[model samples]
Target chain A: MAEENLKGLMLPVVIGKLLAPLPLFPLQFILSRMVRGIAQRRPEFFARLGSHIDSSYAIDVTELPFVLLLKPNPRNPELTAHRRPDKVASDASIAGPFMELFKVLDGRGDSDAMFFSGNLKVSGNTEAAVCLRYALDDLEGSVIEDLLHMGGPALMPAHLLLQRLRRLEMQA
Target chain B: MNTQAITPNAKPELVCPAGTPAALRAAVDSGADAVYCGLANETNARNFAGLNFTPDLLEQGIAYARGRGTKVLLAVNSFATAPRTQLWFDAVDTAARLGVDAVIVADIGVASYAAEHHPQLRLHLSVQAGASSPEAIRYYCSEFNVKRVVLPRILTVTEIAAIHREIPCEIEAFVFGNIGMMSEGRCSLTNYVTGTSTNMDGVCSPANAVHYMDLPDGSKTAGLGDFEIDCFAAGEHAGYPTICKGRYLSPVRKEPYYAFEEPVSLNLSSLLPDLIAAGVTALKIEGRQRSRSYVQAVVSAYRRAVDDIAAGRWHDLSGLVALTEGGKETQGAFQTKKWR
Candidate 1:
């Protein structure tokens, strides 16, 4: 194959692969940050949303080894925008009094960020870790962004953009 | 402008959890103004073994409590599904028929139904409802006419004060027992593993699936299905393994860590005055599955605390530490948000 022809094909293919995640990347980024902001600033909203979580019967998150628990403050439930932290834990290592102690000590006993920093530990399962992380990421990004945008300009777009970048990484 | 004429008693009511008929009587007799309990079925959050009141027993329990000037709050505080909606509905109806003071509900559908159909019945929002903010509380109050809210185990005294300032309904907060770190209304940990959701089914770590094995190391391992929730060393109290309270291994650190939470009780005895100042109406004790003796002891201690506070007396509640999970207790979200 000629060098010119090969280069053209490779560029398009590479561009196709690279740009594929672009739209979603920006969206995910914005969404994730929006979730962060909401998690940090507007916990009451998160708590309210959590209270209304779909209760369909399924698997138990407690059984998983790694759990990334994230919810807005229960006292104030206002769906807001921004990136929020998570409460990350391994199921095997931390479960009861330890998790409670960590929560009370972190000064964010109710904040979702405690789970992400490994203050709370899960013990046995690894898939739980991944799923919990992804679930939290998704909640921060997709749920907050969508809900805020639908709700009103009470949400900041530029703020969400920065948050998106912080939450989601561009594919290398 | 007779501001003092209202004279509202802001003294926090000791809300005790009654897992059985006997526990109910113990709580009521021990100076508990309000006693909360769930049904025998998985419709309540504490769906543990050898706990909760049957419909017949609930009637007797309510009568017993009411006759003693104690209020009975029936906790139907769990999720209801399409298939199980009837059970929850029936529970509510039965609670109303049994002359209970209020029915604690978490589900939107259930709340709406109770509000609409049982216009005369009083509805209290469950912590499982997770209605934490002023707006959310207001929404429930306006929409469903919910009279009181069992606030989640998350909130500083200042935060509670702020919320109390804005909301109109009565506020109840947990003062002792299992401090659920997860958002009460939205958590789905139970359903994710055992195919049963606490939010919907009102059960966490359902009994049939929970198993315990005494390991050779003098530590007992508790499991749900094939998953190991926790391993307790001998001489240390081993709580039944629930997913939220399970132990886990962290990749960042090789040591096993409590991923979700530990078995710690939130004892806010030191903050009783602060809670009273916050205009709280009730202080809840979280143990419906506890023994009657446990109920009596905890309730009596809390009752004394409430009276002492009201009488302008100050005493340390640290003496009750042995009653807490792992023989430890913390202020929960009442202090700073230092959740480590």
Candidate 2:
């Protein structure tokens, strides 16, 4: 189990290292389009957030150089990447490694377990963050899994493939 | 009295939980014999913001679960405050109207209302009812026609066996998840700070009142309302600041200690046979605030465990301890008489 967790930690850490020095504009453009796409595709999911539908969220991947500012606005959602320490106003902020946050979004990992384990940290309006967690939790299918399939256009495929192999090793 | 018989069924019912329609569906699909949930109101004990179901969604959930051979139990469990008693009545009316298999109720007033009005609806006493003895259990059975009494989590198996031999109604015991100090329906610990409670308002340390913040020295503290209940250094496990589970500072203790109860979950996997021996007619997993994955994982695990035990086998389920608060699990006064 420990080996598998370490292996799961590797891809995101390695990816963060690889992408750290890269320019942010293209990534920001991809994020914006994906955010709008999600808003269009999953309006009902966003609606489940209830009063927090328009709440701003900061997804700070501690291992990465940039953070994501997201507003799950029902009409016009926004997700943008910005450099860390260059603050973005948000109603709530969830900081964690990329993989753990991805796991929480997809329901593969328990957010309570993550939060208690100190793997996932939340600050500023914890209720809003919790509401977001529930909304993501009840999402019909894994959002990150869906995004991975979409992201597998290249690097993500290799990374996830390695993770799956490590899981197989653990089972063995 | 339809005591449901004291013969004890060949296998205990596996009662699971769901906070939303999706979780209800997942619980049913994961092989829950019965799935329990509540309305998006104070009538539900887990009245978290954005959790539980609106009546319309509950209708959908019932339709889906019933179609899949799963019983949907409606929880109208929170105590009804004065003048607001009608809300609880309306919830019972909604349950009867929705054709739920049973209504788990905590308040005697709510149970009486359900018994008088929705006479056709099956009534299961909620654990919040805190029926731990034959006398209380029989009172509910005689007065409200309660078919099952969910025992408080404070009973030892031997004590339960003793009660089981005397009670006329079926026995339901909590087998997993949070264990309180067993003060159910009367504990004012959370209300002292948050001004809300499980029995009255169907919430403990309500999300709006619970906060987590980081300190300057890189420690995280969990607070309920205005009180900082517990603090954790890095890598230390943290739990929600529900007053019962929160640690506190006392001048008597050198350092902080669990002044109320430690944040540990109850896991009764190893005691399943013992619970059956004690004539537990059903096993309840208590987690309505959890996600679909949680429902699926726990329900599926217990489903397999119960089926295996029925087929004359047993397997280790200690892995489930990892899902608990502070990564700790206790039998919680089930095997032993020890609990906070």
Candidate 3:
């Protein structure tokens, strides 16, 4: 996709304003359960991180209302949300559009390809981000599938968001 | 009457790299004749934090490959330190016990131990062994019964053919991957600061000591330990921070330049026919530390090239440029001597 096409997918001002007052509890609850399921599915995912198992990652979707903070602590894996103004104490940050980052997570695309194409921007601890990419690359299952299945009614808004993404992709 | 006879050489084995179980499957599915991997220890050269396989994972990978008639070569290629001789020996023993097709070894001590303890195991000399000459190659073949030798990435195609004519064992050459200017199994220059070597400890610049900081001027700085590798402009492709590959200053030159070598991947794709004619037994794809996507793309591309050569079909492997380091590639000393 073109740079402008992807950049345009960032949450518009109107949507951001609408989601500003929305409670994060439902999304947090859904994410917590998804993390539990993912942890159970791929137990070695965290173990694969080696020394970076303790490091936290900020998975940012450009223009999105909230960013995801993931800590693959094998004992107690954590995946929480942090909106703007809430500082994310992360070791590394990987920022891209939702679909771009989504492609990497679901194994449709790779970090190297995404990075080289200038779609994804990685900052902060380079090594830790690399370890995370290595771990994620080794994932055989789909993270999107895990999320979609976990969220029933709570995922309706997310489902609508996916439809919007698809339309934008079609327009491109 | 003038007549030239043309008989294509037998198809050389396509040895793909496997960083993880997923990568192993990707290789096998993509028409690899063999897949090489190392255990998740200091046993292999690519000892990155999250790379390599566990014994259980290896077992699964081996099983998956075996079902598809793809051979598995386990690499216990790192030097066996005095304190950790048992670890290398145990790795060799595991290879034998697991029924691996062969074990790639570099260190003489490790080879001797494998030959002594596991006489039934097949030993392939790793490039890290630095067995470049016929004498060195012969010595290894005689002492350790090495079936094949992965020639270092520093030899010209003519030199490879010359070595092949002289050596008793089969020859394996690197067809594509990172172009290391330093000698194989000797990742030492700036390693004194890091207290590790990719050849032994399996880390060049250890991950924990690496740092990347964004500058106020829209440039980025990469630091490995106390040494700052390079400062890249905002849009420049940021490479991995290995000191030797980093640009540096000098008294004579106006600007800092790549003293060692640039980050160009070794791509010997166009020389597939020359390699086959030269009696190369196998073609190894480097990057066991790279992702499964890399494994899949590279292996499949080479697979088509090799197969096209066999079936007498048109082949274009130029699309693989996207996968190479910084989108730049070199045949690296394969076609000509880069060093005097």
After superposing candidate 3 on the true structure, give the runs of residues whose Cα lies further than 4 Å from its correct spot.
Answer: A1-18, A116-119, A152-172, B1-9
Higher-ranked by lDDT: 1 or 3: 3
First chain of candidate 2, TM-score? 0.82
The reply for model 1, stretches above 4 Å from the true place, is A1-172, B1-8
Per-prediction interface RMSD in Å? 18.0, 1.3, 2.0
For model 3, residues B1-340, the per-residue Cα lDDT tens digits are 1112225556799999998888899999999999999998898888777888888888988999999999999999889898888888999988998999999999999999999999999999999888899999999999999999999988898999999999999999999988785587776865776777777876777777777777777677777888888777877777777877888888999997888889788888888878878889899999887888899999999998888877766678899987888888888888888542
Return whichever of 1 and 2 wins on DockQ.
2
The C-alpha RMSD in Å for every predicted model, in order, reads 24.6, 4.0, 3.1
**Candidate 2 structure quality by residue, lDDT tens digits, B1-340:** 1112223356899999998777898899999999999998899788887788888988999889888898999999999989999999999999999999999999989999999998999999988888877888999999999999988888899999999899888888999888887677778888889888767898888888878988788789999888998999876888888887777888888888887788998899988887887888899998989878778888888998887777667556777877877889889889777654
lDDT of 3 by residue, A99-161 (tens): 667667666567876774556777878779888888888887667766766667877887776
| Decoy 2 TM-score against native | 0.91
TM-score of 1: 0.64
Cand. 1: chain B TM-score: 0.94
Pairs that clash in candidate 2 = none
Model 3 TM-score, 2 decimals: 0.92
Chain A TM-scores, candidates in order: 0.23, 0.82, 0.78
- CAPRI tier of model 3: medium
